[model samples]
Target: MLDLALEIAAELIRRPSVTPEDGGCQDYIEALLQPYGFRRIRIDRGGVTNSIFLRQGERAGCLAFAGHTDVVPTGPLIDWPHDPFAAVVENGMLHGRGAQDMKGGIACWLAASIRLLRDGVPIPTMQLLITSDEEGESIDGTIHIVKHLQSHGMLPDAALVGEPSSHRIVGDTVRRGRRGVMQVRIRFDGKQGHSAYPQDADNAIHRAIPALHRIIDLDWGNPAAGFPATTCQITNLNGGTGASNVIPGHCDAFLDIRYNPANSADEIESMLRNACNAEHVQLEFDRVADAFATPDGPFLDSVTRAIRDTMGIEPRLDTGGGTSDGRFLAKAGIPVAEIGLTNATIHQIGECVALEELAALSAIYASLIRNFEVNG
Candidate 1:
């Protein structure tokens, strides 16, 4: 099983499928699963590749493993110890761009499923929800797949997202939820004039400082249980012209907010707009991703039990992360759990994963599949 996972992971890493590009990764996956009685359903849209590989089981329920074939861009080839797309294995590590972030997790899940089938183990109905639009603008990614499944009444009983959620070791942590993201762009208007002529020119920077201070001081309210407090940060600010003597006509500031379920996007927007009450200020808000959580229940218990039984350690149920496609599934009423390899080197120059970690994760996934049962 470990050797099969390593081979599959290496093949996926060598594809160079940057965000919004599958680079034939899905084609390879289809070929591998076709012989195992898995049927492929394509949901390609807006130049993004999405696929659903399904295999009917002799058991009672359907379980899905959601993942992405896309990887973030490798910063620079010269800075990496090995070629980012080479998928080199040395010193017990597999080095490549998607080695830890996602492709490795997908490979492990595939290996586990195949191993179970080969061993003649009866498993639940299985689906592989794979997309290529995760690391980019996720407009037409898993949401589309989820919508299609809903229309056809084919939603899975539960889903496990392959997002590399472990912080230190495989099976040590699993993210049951993620904080939502909201971004705001504020532009303050003022007349451009010489800095020396304060009376003739209204200083945009002067107007921005007090307003921004008010925004910074606004209260976002208490966080929900088992989640972090909402955080708002001024990520970018620009006001002055190239010439020191000129007062800028416009000042732009960008706010990135990560809010929990306690606060809605509507409330956050209202707070920002009310704080920046000046007549000349214009605000643009983008609700990038909505916050989601899966309550402690049978699905989570089964996953944690599998981890504990496989690795002899209890997995921590965490709710910290940027965002993921799991939010889409969670919103659609599917119990979601994110369990994968350690994410220490994800999106880094020398991104890599230990071969041992891959084997352990594969074992956990196989256990989960073998013993999975849907609870009402």
Candidate 2:
């Protein structure tokens, strides 16, 4: 199982699938699972590649694994010890761009399923939801696959997102929820003129200061249990001319808010509008990803038991992280748990994972699949 996982992970990393591009990775996946009786269902949308691989089970209930084939851009290739897409194995580590963020996780799940099937294990029906739009806009990836499942009434009983959720060790942590994302683009308008002629100029920078301060001062209140408090940050601010003597006519400010379930996107938008109350200021709000949490239930208990049996350790149920494709499934009312390899180097220049981590994670996934149950 370890050898199979390492081979697949290396092959996947060899494909340079930078955001929104499958780069033939899913095609490769299809070829691997086709011989194993898994039917491939394509759900491509807006040029993003999405696939659902399904296999009927000998046991009752359906289990799904959600993952992405896309990887974030490798900034400054020279900084990496090995080529970002080479999949180099050095000192027991598989080094590459997607090694830890996702592709490694996907490989482990595949290995586990295949091993179980070959060994004649009677596991539940399985669905592998793969998408290429996660590392980019995330507009037309898992969201479309989820909609298709809903239309066909084929939604799985539960889903495990392969998002590299663990921190220090495999099975040490599983993300039960993630905070919501809200982005706001605010434009403060005013007349542009010379700095010397202060009376003639309606400085946009001057107009933006008070409103920004008000936004920063807005109360977010306490967060929900096992979650962090709502955080609003002014990520970007631009309002200047080339000449120091010029007073800018407009200032654009971008706000990125990660809030727990305690705060709704609508509530945050309302508070923001109240802060930037001037008629000259225009605010555009985008509810990127809604906050979602899977309450403790049979699904979670099963995952915990599988981890305990495989790793001999208690796994922490965490709700931290920016966001993930799991939100789409959670929004569809399916219980979602994110369990995967450790995330020490995800999105870093030298993103990689240990070979042992893959082996352990694969074993845990195999156990989870063998023990999955449906709510009757």
Q: Which has the greatest TM-score?
A: 1
Residues 139-197, candidate 1: write the lDDT tens digits.
Answer: 89999999999999999999999899998889999999999999999999998999899
> Using Cα atoms with residue i matched to residue i, what is each candidate's TM-score against the true structure?
0.85, 0.82
Off by over 4 Å in 2: 76-79, 184-222, 232-256, 271-283
Question: How well does candidate 1 score on lDDT at residue 107?
Answer: 96
Clashing pairs for predicted structure model 1, backbone only:
none
Tell me the tens digit of each residue's lDDT in model 2 across 78-175: 99999999999999999999999899999999999999999999989999999999989888999899999999999999999999999899999999
Q: What lDDT would each prediction earn against the true structure? A: 0.93, 0.94
